[model samples]
Target chain A: MSHTTLQKKKLIARVSRLKGQMEAVERALEAERPCGEILQLLASVRGALTGLTGEVLDDHLREHVLNAEDDAARAEAVEEISEVLRTYIR
Target chain B: MSHTTLQKKKLIARVSRLKGQMEAVERALEAERPCGEILQLLASVRGALTGLTGEVLDDHLREHVLNAEDDAARAEAVEEISEVLRTYIR
Candidate 1:
């Protein structure tokens, strides 16, 4: 299997957990929970997201950047990751 | 009503939408969609999250920092927000 396909199960699991966290935030807001609690939840979600992003990025670097078949392909891979990172960090 | 309470409905709406976006990512990953598509979805989710965080922070600034009753309270509010921001930006 391709590297990405191999990682699919784990990645999906992380996304499912993230969905649950988002749902909890929604429920907390609907129930008029305190701002402090809500902010705490948001912080946790943000952390989880960062973690997921890092994992995906690591995989991308391995499959695309590091394993590129040629210099041209490596450059393209670098640009793609750079573009995504630009959008992501903003 | 307090500022946070006043914004609860809108905030919840945003959270619900975020939940939906996250669900899409989960589905995409499960179906083994292309990595590019998954990254795009992830980026959009991240953007939505940043927007939500900004809205909550705005309300926090208005209700807690700007309208704080005294110097001590203001200091505490500043510290609280700073702590959250530090964790968030990490």
Candidate 2:
């Protein structure tokens, strides 16, 4: 199922923030900022993006995979989710 | 930089495949497949999803962040990317 309208709005807002972060990176480049400083900012932006990704991913898991009615299904979903999340988020 | 139309289409195709994998997971759940069996399928789906994520992330690093005009910028970008990639993927 899709997220509620409110959730969609929140997600869009997160995306907008990511866009802003991208612009910041661009500006820093134009300004010829120090490499160390630029790295710090980029790292911050990446962290936010990952956090957003994780939240959306968790929502999908709970809403779609976890709703399965059987024990076996739930267990399987949990395993896949754990594996993917562990591998993907890093 | 935005991808060329061809790249966008390719990415969409990958997303379509991901959609199919999700549906497959849903069908297995609906069919009451054994938990172990369903876990295998879900794990497969997650793996594919993670692979897709990694591909897109790598592209962004190469096309946007890594092209900085200076060595220092490159170094900083590399550090941030390495950290984020390690932290985000399993």
Per residue, candidate 2 scores C-alpha lDDT tens digits across A13-53 of 55456556645655554555543344455555556655655
Winning candidate number (DockQ): 1
Q: TM-score of model 1's chain A, to 2 decimals?
A: 0.85
lDDT of 1 by residue, A19-43 (tens): 8998888888778776767877998
Candidate 2 per-residue lDDT over residues B1-90, each given as its tens digit: 332122555654564565565455455545555433444554555566556556655655775466665787567667756765665555
Question: Quick one: best lDDT, which candidate?
Answer: 1
Q: Write the per-residue lDDT of candidate 1 for residues B1-90, one digit (tens) a residue.
A: 445578878888888899899888888877777666677788888889988887787787878789877888778778768878899665
Assess each model's interface with DockQ, reporting 2 decimals per model: 0.63, 0.07
DockQ (C-alpha) of model 1?
0.63
Alpha-carbon RMSD of each model: 2.4, 9.8
What candidate 2 gets wrong by more than 4 Å, as runs, is A4-6, A68-90, B1-90
